[model samples]
Target chain A: MQYLSVVDVARHFGRRKALSQISFSCAAGEMIGLLGPNGAGKSTLLNILATLIAPSKGEVKYGDQGANDGADVRAQIGMLGHDLFLYPELTARENLEFFAHLYGVTDVHSTATRALHTAGLVDRGDDFVAGFSRGMRQRVALERALLHEPKLILLDEPFTGLDQTSTAALVGRLRERQRAGCLIVLATHDLDVADGVLSRAIYLKDGRMVGSDTGSSNLADRYRRAMDRGPRNADSALWGGE
Target chain B: MMRAFFRVAWQVMRKDMTVEIRSREILLTTLLFAVSVVLIFSFALVREGRAPDDVAAGILWVAISFSGTLAMGRTFERERYNDTLRALILAPADRPAIYVGKLLGLLLLMLLVEIVLVPMVGLLFAAPIFAYPGMLLMLLVSGTLGFAAVGTLFAAMLVRVRSRDTLLPVLLYPITVPVMIGGVRGTAALFQAVPDEPMARFWIGLLLFWDAIFVTLALWTFEPVMTE
Candidate 1:
């Protein structure tokens, strides 16, 4: 019954429209993909979902609770964005433990250790993230975001730069989370990896929702087709991401 | 609720201190810069081994404020570097608690630098060394608290801004005038050949008042300013 609903959400930045009339809803146990090309406002939508920014218009409801419902609402949401949010000066374990503590996770030491194991960085847990390769840091950051077992996870470009092996590992982990019944909303250009894993795809272009459906097919082709169409002709189906 | 707020604040402060302990980037740069400021003024203002009247106190505060800006600049730079501020903003902790934690961390760093700075100014400028230790400590703490209360807020506000390095001082120095006046005047009264106990006490009282106002304002506005 838990769900996230966006009602006519729009965000603008000083004469520039980042997102406009965007509307969708995703229920728990669903994984929705925000697919688009550059400047598609995918990151903006993700930021709005994470409560990092407010929409200039409309409202976002998290199971009848909004972001203004206070810190408790934020506690149930986790995010991973372009920055990775990990301190390079801190060791991998330290980074995880720090976030675990902030998230009010009990038994922080063990939680961080478990996260290290999940990231497959148990051997390199003590090493500073400054020296980590892109894929390695990405994995650690992903675990950091998941440490609190958040009910909702917002990720922007979760798989930006990765090798085939790392990409496969990340996809597998995401699928595992999907099975755990955590609602996930990710902005990704890695359509090939996201193809069938997503329960639905919401295609956006120039700050508007262009297409959306329970399209469990070749995402790249679907994305191309969606982008080629006009907004008036595109499908704007609003579902609970069931 | 109070316990949770304080705990999160302590965690944030401890994390900053840990990073400083490991890196020493801010501390070393700030300490060396403060000492250099003191020494340069001692040479420029002192003549025949005698510093001009009230110059030592002015020199000390100028050093503190200039070096404090440098220190405060680095406080959020680390967060801005990796966009850790985004992570922090997304945390479930009360926004004001996070501000308090950052202020606490900055206060400790400023006090550490002042420990070396005060004595160095005394020795170089021939100011009274042991006139009143308690009064000097109170002035330092109150002045630092007031100054850093404003600095922390501005630093947080400027984290995502461009040309922030050039902007921090421009924004910081003008806003912290009352704090600087209270600090310099209070310390001068203490350093004078005839220690003006009542005069130093007045400035200390004034600085404490400013501390209350700045801290309250910063805590109140922190959440809104940071929300973006």
Candidate 2:
């Protein structure tokens, strides 16, 4: 089975440290929740893992291979970032078809059609994304990320702006995919959602890993404890607690 | 691997074509800008009591340059609004394929406008460009390719910059002087009351050289600039 290992990863934006000395490892069939406050480097970590931006230090590896500056490793990772990355002018089907070709999908049309169905956008496939409501656009973006059927999925704040029905629908799809042995990482501030969906939760604050909950219990409470402990003098305690 | 790269590039171009066909936004705006520039030049030159043909090459290229910039700007503006550039970069394909794909799309749109602009210039200014159709075409392709090569790179680079629309021409025009000069001189030789075959050949050679150098650079630099 495939697995991901990120060791001592650090990223700096000029003099500002965005992420520092972050390390974690997870195998396929596990859903990890990346929980953090604002500016806690959730997006930066996902970006590094997605290979959108290189880490300033350390490494990200899949199986035994490093996330080198090549398309081979990136081919296995799917990311839905803060930006939806969908063309508003293109219909949802067209957007999926275009991305399918880029990912070298064997049959662009059939694959795109399947993805549209998965996102529950089959009826709305031909409508321009420009007119889509926020929930609909999010669904299209989700389909676009899944269009290539990547092995590792990283979603940053995927639940944002989603209504109850849309959120439930998306969560069900994610659960289905996770059960299929795909490794998933979700970054969100919603502790309730994180508690409900994730098997483990990794907490980050001020560019450092505060703690991680591995026992699959009290994730929101543990997350609050981790965040409240703060990083000034609690680093050692946090490590020992983990 | 090369086949895959070209295939990705073709898909990107095809997607752009489909979008442009449906929206008609880039095509109409570029055409309107090109025609407006030509008409405005015609009136200005007529007021100066100058035969439009005497300066036909300059007018034609200026119109092409301005309109091409407009087209390139709109092309990325759409990408910016939807953050689709990130999607393009995230694709599991060769990085250069994306640049080549966008360059091809821009070239096609620019050519579509030139198809109309060329005949109008000949009819309105009596430049006799139709007298040397093959030579005129050679000059146009080389020059436009060179311009597109550099313009496409800068446009992608400036996609996230605050003042990208204005910054593109400011950055692009300076770097592309060689292409612009070569194009204007080549067209001038063709438009002269007594055409200069040797002069046109020299400028065409320069234009081709300019294109070769810039396209190679764009292919090499696109990955780094865009990813960062």
Candidate 2: regions farther than 4 A off: A215-217, A232-242, B48-53
Candidate number achieving the greatest DockQ relative to the actual structure = 1
Enumerate residue pairs that collide in model 2.
none
* Per-residue lDDT over A1-242 for candidate 2, one digit per residue giving the tens place of the 0 to 100 score: 54999999988787677788899999898889888888788998988888888898999998877767479877888888777998887889988888998998999999988988878888999999889998899988988888777889999999998888988887888888899888999899877666768977898987888888775667777887989975764344233332
lDDT of each: 0.89, 0.87
True contacts kept of each: 0.69, 0.75
Top candidate by TM-score: 1
**lDDT, candidate 1, at A103:** 84
Model 1 sits at an interface RMSD, in angstroms, of 0.9
